[model samples]
Target: MKDREDILRQIEELQKKFLEILANNPGIVVVNSDQTGQVKETHSTRTLAPEGEKDVVVEIENASATTHAVTVLPTIYLDGRQHPKVYVHLGEATGALPKFKPVYSNPNLVIGASKSHIMNKEGTERFLKEVLFIQPMPKHMLLLIDSWPLFLNHSFIQQFVPQGHKVTILNIPKGGTSLSQPLDLNYNQQWKSVMRRLNDAILIHEIDYKIHVRDNLLRAISQVYWCFGAPRFCEFRRYGWYKGGYLDTHPAPFVTPPKYLFGEGSEGDCTCGEPGLILCPYCEKPHCFICFVANSHRCA
Candidate 1:
């Protein structure tokens, strides 16, 4: 657990080293990898207790995440250029993944399961194999990761990340992940927020399905992540790198989900005056409610 000063000093030295490496090889793909956990969320929508009766739903106080809840682990990476892909692992020793996953439209996502909703060695391998390995060979590769035990397995990494062609692994010091890791600085939170909003919004709209159910849960997960292909997500990826102190210039003039969905300030509106416009899947243009939803836009 490095102190703030130590972390800053280490980041400075690391930035210097990274710049030197880039100065020599500009085509190197720097990857920041990490996993995050999300609980199979039950409705947090509050309801009042009837007279002489207990509340219909009550949340446990400080419930244990590891032992109690059924969680899902989504492993992702941002290469500071493209939109990140997702690898979701079902936890609680549930059976295999959903019989039919909805993420087929995007062949990049890989969904799996583990006893603990945590990224085990196998999960790590699958994540790389499914998400990272298939990428076109770059001039060189730099894997920036947290000091997770499995990530320390040089042997396992060599299985796919080719050792000789300048395969460099830089670990973010333990307990310093949020302070120094690009994916952790802000991107993960936004991703999860969008994921949650997507699920909750569908449920609220009475989508005629149970979002907490395994298949539907997987569907919602896939649908939310499919939007990762949006070019603006790439901007968020690079902005995260700059925020993590890995890049020299800020990825400014950027608008991530948090800004677009909920305006950071005054927001422009369409004729319908809908501030929350959905971007067209094909054109990336903002769509108003009447035009996109009521009128039945091309890409539903």
Candidate 2:
């Protein structure tokens, strides 16, 4: 028993060291958004969390049965409580959308694919195309995938063409899938060939890592891995985020550092109901939710 316990302790220490090494490696990051609008981050080697009490909020309003539509707004709590003030002007909600937010306190690092985002055959194909089309790729690229066809398809297997610094993908999946052609086989055979084509592509992975596909896969990739996986995602997601707006960029003002850091500064309420130092300073303003537009005139 004593010997076994010692061995277990040594193994634990070794695992920690391994994780540290992988986290520092330059590779890819994966980003995932589920029905709950919770964001998950993944990286090629490990996972990490956004540091703070921040909780991503997604609001849905005007929901009806027949008229179904979904809008996602990522946000964090103003105070320590569970109140997520982020608003989404969704039309209706019938089907379930698994929106996931990261637990910024203890985030997973960007590693391989998270199973949450991996969909059926068609979904996998669409995701692969998105990865291929992203322009101005980052220094290191990471892909989080689960489907065998999408992972091994010719479109992706063409070769590693590094337009930027680095590129990699985290292939995620459940244990008992009916995939005859495992992605690992294709990757092992073609990875070297692809690397040669890119000239500067770097691949990062740990052989013994057991990644959870359903829960942490998308979360790990989206929040952390996306940075390395798709550095140009800011340009790509905007196309989807701003479909309702003109000018190509998103019409909505993305949450900045100031917004997240400047929570309730005072004991009393500013127009938004949360206590903060920077009051709306406007009498007509109803709440702090719209204070961005309203208080900007009076305060700023």
CA lDDT, every model vs. true structure: 0.59, 0.28
Residue lDDT tens for model 1, 138-223: 54777787778888776788687644465667777776787777877877787677655544444444344445555555555555
lDDT of 2 by residue, 45-128 (tens): 222224574543322222132222222222111111111121122221222233464321212121112223333343333333
Measured by lDDT, the strongest candidate is 1
In model 2, what is the error at residue 230, expressed in angstroms? 18
Give candidate 2's TM-score. Answer: 0.27
Model 1 TM-score is: 0.72
Per-prediction count of colliding residue pairs? 0, 67
Off by over 4 Å in 2: 1-62, 65-136, 145-166, 175-287, 293-300
